[model samples]
Target: MTNSSAKTRAPLSRPIIAGVVTALVGFTSSFAVVLTGLAAVGATPGQAASGLLALSLTMGIACIVLATRYRMPITVAWSTPGAALLAATGLVEGGWPAAVGAFLVVAALILLTALVPQIGALIASIPASIAQAMLAGVLLPLCLAPVTGLALNPWGVAPVAITWLIFARLAPRWAVPFAFVAATVVVIIGVVTSGKTVDPALLIPQLEWTAPTFTLGAVIGIALPLFVVTMASQNVPGIAIMRSYGYEVPWRPAMLVTGLGTAAGAAAGGHAINLAAISAALAAAPEADPDPRRRWVAGLSTGISYVLLGGCAAASAALVLLAPPAVIPAVAGIALFAAFGSSVQQAIDDPGERIPAVVTLLVAASGVAVLGISAAFWAIVAGLLVRGVLHLGRR
Candidate 1:
């Protein structure tokens, strides 16, 4: 009895440590992207901080609830791809409030997907190649930031790029987080050199709520594309990853929890939260614990850590706000390199899909807005149209 008790307690610490690391890595690696996305869509610094705080709290709560209730290592995260999509989409009609409205629309769509099976089926029917092509196109411009920043502000961007390169070759998983640290150092040095001081008051987290206003352009341009990317890139892949680890995720419950969390956060400027894809392994893998049954503790611990991290959202946002122009964007860009490569590979994997994929990529990279709709929506339309034309009667 003593041996069994000791054995059980011993493994608990591993999962707990794994959970903390997951939260740290996941938050640090991509929070820059979240801030960049929110600012791009016209959010003020206060509102952007609120968005980050809301996302952290909501997803953390979702993870705790899901993991505890289901007894599985089901982790939750903000949609990084969806945030990238917002960064690419930029400001839509009616500015930040409309973007907030679009966020709410995405939340509703996610809820609908859980309640109505057909909605998810329709999204699933979209060709993987086309969907990925659109994603690749959206990522292209943002991914170019590192190069552009290097040319524009080498002093600030070089340290970040070099740190990322070194770590990417050695410790691939921690590369982005390290780059962020380097960027933060650069920001601090610049502040000191310029005799500028950061206001302590700005570092305190506060929620800034925006009343949402719906518009046709924001709905089609931001909401639809965001929903598609979150589903295709985050939620679906997350489920598959967990299944590969021999855990059957409860889909409806997961969707409902994420959907409701998203809705709760939308007014506070949060974009979307969903199942974790890339970071799910940190909590669910064998390294988290030899016993699969105990891995859920890691997920629970991750949620708690994230909730605590929410307190730092204002400070994180303040750092980005103070970051010398290209520094933050460069970090955001390097953090996305892995995602960009995967998207491009999957976008043009099929011989027949190459032309349509290229077309989509070009259109999305062009950053064109027609009839107030952003390039992302048009990229999808253009890809599907070209694909349909080429395959006409081929079947």
Candidate 2:
């Protein structure tokens, strides 16, 4: 690269760096969590890798098409956040089969929401505070994983996590990048050399695909939560990021895309495919290109990367096991802390419902699972119930 070209590109480097980092996180930390969720439900390694492959393909194609036509830096992602919701699906009575059925149900919800604005409105009608609370609550337990993960290699991850928290506190822009770098090095030195490696074969994908089975356990338990999670975690955040950047992508088709993609992923041994927010922000921002008209090219570029990876299932498996477990938790926790704080603050800002809102936030952060529903979802339900009862008694 010539000095002049390097200098020219430097101005746009921030957004590019952010975009690349976000995508990396989507694959490494976020992908690892998804695998963990899959295993919690007894999905074999083959199914987990298949799920990742399917999501990448679906997201890649959709993102390329939408962003190109729209002439924006739009991004599409498999529902990484939906891992929280997938917890119940993984533990259902029929396990993977039931989970697939549940995925279809969620897909139906996505289709319905896309076709019906009233449904979107109903989803939107949930107070921003509650949504924030729900988000924070869902993510709260996940944040704790890094801390415990650090215990696995305190000397390695402890320093990385500490450095990340400090950097996140002082330098918002550099936090993730710096922490990721530090963690990667530590994993190599601390975890990898310590002989924590799984058999390379155990981590590779099995190309053999299985057909999905419909089941009652999946419909009642897995499907319901998957729908809620995809909505709460993926769609909600995705729309917010788009709105934040002044894009007006229609929600209906987007929701349909998410639902359908998830169904495909389920059939391929994956769970919860939906839009992405954090990485999408990096792509949609002005830094993707100086002339917004050309931004589609960047989306096209990302899509190409996705396509290559999706076709190579073995690569996906290797990527999943590429990083140390501790690294995933630290990256995720540090990344979401600010958003989590904001949610907590928003949930309690209303003077009338301040006390109850606090209750909502606490319930969500508690990570308590009841009736197979996540704490985040239940927190919203519980808060709404409390808020409703209080409102009604006054009436």
Candidate 3:
């Protein structure tokens, strides 16, 4: 009896450790982008902290519920790409309240996708090249932050960049997380040298709810683009990754859970939560467990870790609030390098779609706003119009 119990406990340990690693990697890697995105859309520092906490709690709960129910290593995450879109779109016609409304709209759209099969099919019918091109365009300005920050604040940004480059060669998986570590160090040194004191009260986690106020411009500019990005870059890819790992995720339940999670968090400033993309493999892969059936333990562990990490959201947000200018943005940029590369690659992969894709990229990268709508919406419009014209009369 003792020997059998030991064997059972021994195999379980590996997956539990993998789950903790997944949460750590997932949280530390892109929380900066979330903060940056929230701030760009007119969230105050306190509000941004609230957003982080909301996302952490909601997605953590989501992972726990889905993984346990399906007995698969299904993980949920805050939408990193959607956050980037918010950052690029900036303050919309109706300010922060409007942005919150846009978040709610995205939630409704996601729920609709789950309830009505045609909605998901419509989103799926969007050309991959065009979708990826718009994302690439939106990401371009952000990816330039490190280069531009190096020029503007070399002392602060250099160390982060060097750390990232070193780890990128030695351990690619940890490069961005290491860069964030370096940035934290830089921020601490800056604080010490400048004799600035951080408020202890600010470190305590709290949610600040905003009553949403919808506007047409925000709907078109922020809500639509955010939904598209979350679906194309996060949710869809997340499903494909799980399928590759031999887990047939129940589509409706997954959508319903994430959509409901997004709705619950929207008022607290979270932009969106969706299925995990890049970090999905961390929990689902064979490395998580020799036996695939046991890997769901990792997913449960990840959820619990994230719930605990939610307690630190305020501290993380305070750090970003206190960091010297350009340092945080630099970290955010390094964290997104993989995503930007992937987007650009997919955007131009097809010879036939190259022109429309390029058109979308150029329009989105231009940062043009027409009558309060952001470049992202215009990029989609331009790409589809060009494609329709070029393919005229083709069967």
Candidate 4:
């Protein structure tokens, strides 16, 4: 490649930097889940760092390769759902090793799903409209949560949320990061002026590493749950996210790489890693780059950012503290405003798929709970299942 072309291709564009920052922006939402997963699995602080390392390295490399190879604006991330599972069930551990055993099982299941054309095809069969609806539904809570947070002390949250909404509504690209900064300043003022309480006199730095141990029960219960979350919450969203941006890639290789990333993270006390849906959209959007070919550089830039962030947990924590809770939802809502609206609009624009898509959107938005599975998985499943049954009945 020529020097000029290489430079142009490098992920240094203003949009790319914004995208990377946005991708990393999500670190606030699920970090507790990751740490809880680590603690539940008996990892020391050092082990968590190592897990972060493994997770970042694997995801970083994979995103670069996948984006470059596919020539698409693709982005990857850890399964927020998997991390949630870790937070909830990570307690059932043989420590970090147990989590790894769970990771292995999850990886295996994903491989099976990938190899089995039926499964992948079935997922693909989901109407783009329905898929979009599901995504929009999943994001609804986050959008509203900030508003609800207003009840708390409105001073910290209310101002931020309201201002963010206003700014974001008017000027999304400029408004999002601005909202985050504004909200953080509010929270800082709250903490300083009001004297909010804190736990642990100092942030804990417990770091240790132990080989993973596998227990059948842990694998079945703990690991399987994490796997499901990774696939449902992380991968499904990832594919939809990529497609949302108009990139086409075979799902199998993507699944494999994500599975491997998760396993590698598990080795370090992290949970399932995979293609990022929400955070990635920030980086991979048409807005991130007017030219899609140059977008891979953005993905690569994100990976490099991960390396830096992953290096120091303390630093990560400090950065996390940089933003107030209100900042997260307000800014995230702002950033996602376009994508969500566009996806929903796209899904409903087609009259043939409108009904099924509407059903999917409603089902996803309902937040109903029958099984332990979160609403995300069920939205897709029920939407497709309903569509299938209707088609057969019509025949």
Candidate 5:
């Protein structure tokens, strides 16, 4: 190999830095949502903490093994959108146990897809525009958190917003990280000035395990929808991201590993663990490494960061719980801004699919819930129906 190739292959490079930051972004960006979703489904604080730790550790391990084995940048993440769906689904009949049962079912479905090649092909066959539209819709509400937060707490949010904007202009890749750091600073200052005595003992995460209880309602209403959303919105997009960056890794094995990890997490409270969608770009992009082949180091770095975060999940949860509710969402919005923009652009770019895409986006953004199902699922159904009708009319 040439000297340049040797230099690019060096470990602990800038790509690894980016990977670490990306992992932090992935956790901080949507963890609040995960907590909220779990609580809505009847998880106690301890159970939620356990779930967070479980998902993070398993996802971290998956990312490490897959990257090393395949020599590809394969990042794993908890399904943020799936968590949101669970939150929106509200309280189920069997509560937390039912949610755990649903999680197992979803993992089984993912494992089945991995074992059956046709299922993977079927997911891959989904129209990119439709998928993007649904994702755009799903993310739209969360993206608006900054705006709503600013309205609620200008003093706390303005600094973070400004930090994001400044860094985005001066150092694009660091925008979200900078914003989160700035927000943490702001929160710390508030806590200090307010004289709120927080006992350090509260940081200890109590891991709670809930036995799974299966119900037909949860299996259909929660499991099926969670499986579909995670596959279509996260895993498929993750594959697209890798392809866009010229990385080809086998999908089946990755699915199997993530599926098992997700099932393990379910017993502890996590909803689903799947391929990284938004953060995958950070690890796989040319910005990570000039030489595409060496970027697997980025995935390795991300995995290490995730494991550290898992170790501190309880403390992180405590901090988030203490912060202003709007603050967490605002920080998350900052991290997701680029993703929302890209999804929106792709969703509306094709004229032939525009109407259907719009339908999906609107329904998803509306946050409608019916029969314990989230709008994200119905948005795709609505979009596909419109597309079918349009196609028949054209014929």
Candidate 6:
């Protein structure tokens, strides 16, 4: 609190601020997707809260550990695409327990990818453009939530949108974070004026465990697809984000930690945790700190923030529960617009990969479910098939 200490820490404030912004963006943006996914798998509200807490803690630890060990801004996040896949897939034979089992299976598969180099190689072999396309496809519909909010609550969404637009022009780096602040202000005013309050108990940490049940249907319908989507859409892109910023990341240790983290989360109704994509960019970007070597502080700060947020899981969950249905999604969509734009551009960047990438995008965007499998899994399959056929023709 003293001036001298404050002056000393001033130089490091940018990365710290960036890290906090990244944590807020990641947690606020995709948590609804996680809740919806857990609900679809038959988790009760309490179970869902516990799941969110578990995931937050695991991912926070992963980000902190990996970033510190490697001296790189390695971020971790729950697999948003995998969560969407869960939302689309619905409940399996044994309800929540079966879903838990499926989650464990998916975690084990992720671990296998670390232990068995061939599986990781196989995933890496997929054209990066196609993977980007699939991620874009998965994110496209959610990004429209702000538009949906505009129709449903223009008064609430307009100011947020205008703020983002203004900042994006004047201070591009802070656009999303500024918009988030604007929206948070609006929400607080509405809550206070409306005289609506949440129970303090919701702010307390609680843990719940489900006895997992392994069923063939759950494994086939949920596990495989979840693994594929989390690996392709989240883990791969997350690594690419770090590399895009010129960081050399070791894949095996990262995968092992995330795999272990996902499994730890599964015991408490969480789905999957993987490397972060968008938030990783925030921490890894040069803007986080002038000295690139010290940018790991951003990841460390993000991890610490996530842990704090996890402690407030109950209150955070309650806020989402009380908000206007469209509000959460709109805010989340706004936070994700930059990420969506990047994915779309990357998806089509390579002319040779364009067709397959487009195919993947279209399939993922379609949201088609066939025989209990989600479109994301099919998108990858379809894109790879198209790519293989094209390769054969060249041969």
Report the C-alpha lDDT of model 4 over 277-340, residue by residue, as the tens digit.
Answer: 7777777777677667677767777766665555545433433344454544454444445555
Worst 10 residues of 5 by lDDT: 4-13
Candidate 3 vs candidate 6: the lDDT winner is: 3
Q: Which scores higher on lDDT, 2 or 6? A: 6
| Candidate 5 lDDT by residue in tens digits, 218-298 | 886678768877998788889988898898768899899999998888899978999998889989987787778778988
TM-score computed on alpha carbons, candidate 5:
0.87
- What are the candidates' C-alpha RMSDs? 1.4, 4.7, 1.7, 6.3, 2.9, 4.3
Candidate 1 displacement at residue 94 in angstroms: 0.8
In order, candidate lDDTs are 0.94, 0.64, 0.94, 0.61, 0.82, 0.82
**Cα lDDT for residue 134, candidate 4:** 67
Q: What is the lDDT of residue 178 in candidate 6?
A: 72
My TM-score estimates for the predictions, one after another, are 0.98, 0.80, 0.98, 0.63, 0.87, 0.83
- lDDT string, candidate 3, 168-202, tens digits: 99998899999999999999999999999988999
RMSD in angstroms, candidate 1?
1.4
Counting clashing residue pairs in each candidate, in order, gives 0, 5, 0, 10, 0, 0
* Candidate 3 vs. true structure, TM-score: 0.98
- Candidate 2, residue 275: Cα displacement in angstroms equals 3.3
Candidate 2 local distance difference test against the native:
0.64
- Candidate 2, residues 252-309, lDDT tens digits: the string is 6677666666656666666666677767766677776654555555556566556555
- Cα displacement (angstroms), candidate 3, residue 392, comes to 1.0
Q: In model 4, where do residues sit more than 4 Å from their true spots?
A: 1-57, 64-74, 79-106, 113-116, 166-171, 196-253, 267-272, 276-299, 311-343, 352-363, 371-385
Residue 227 of model 5 has an lDDT of: 84
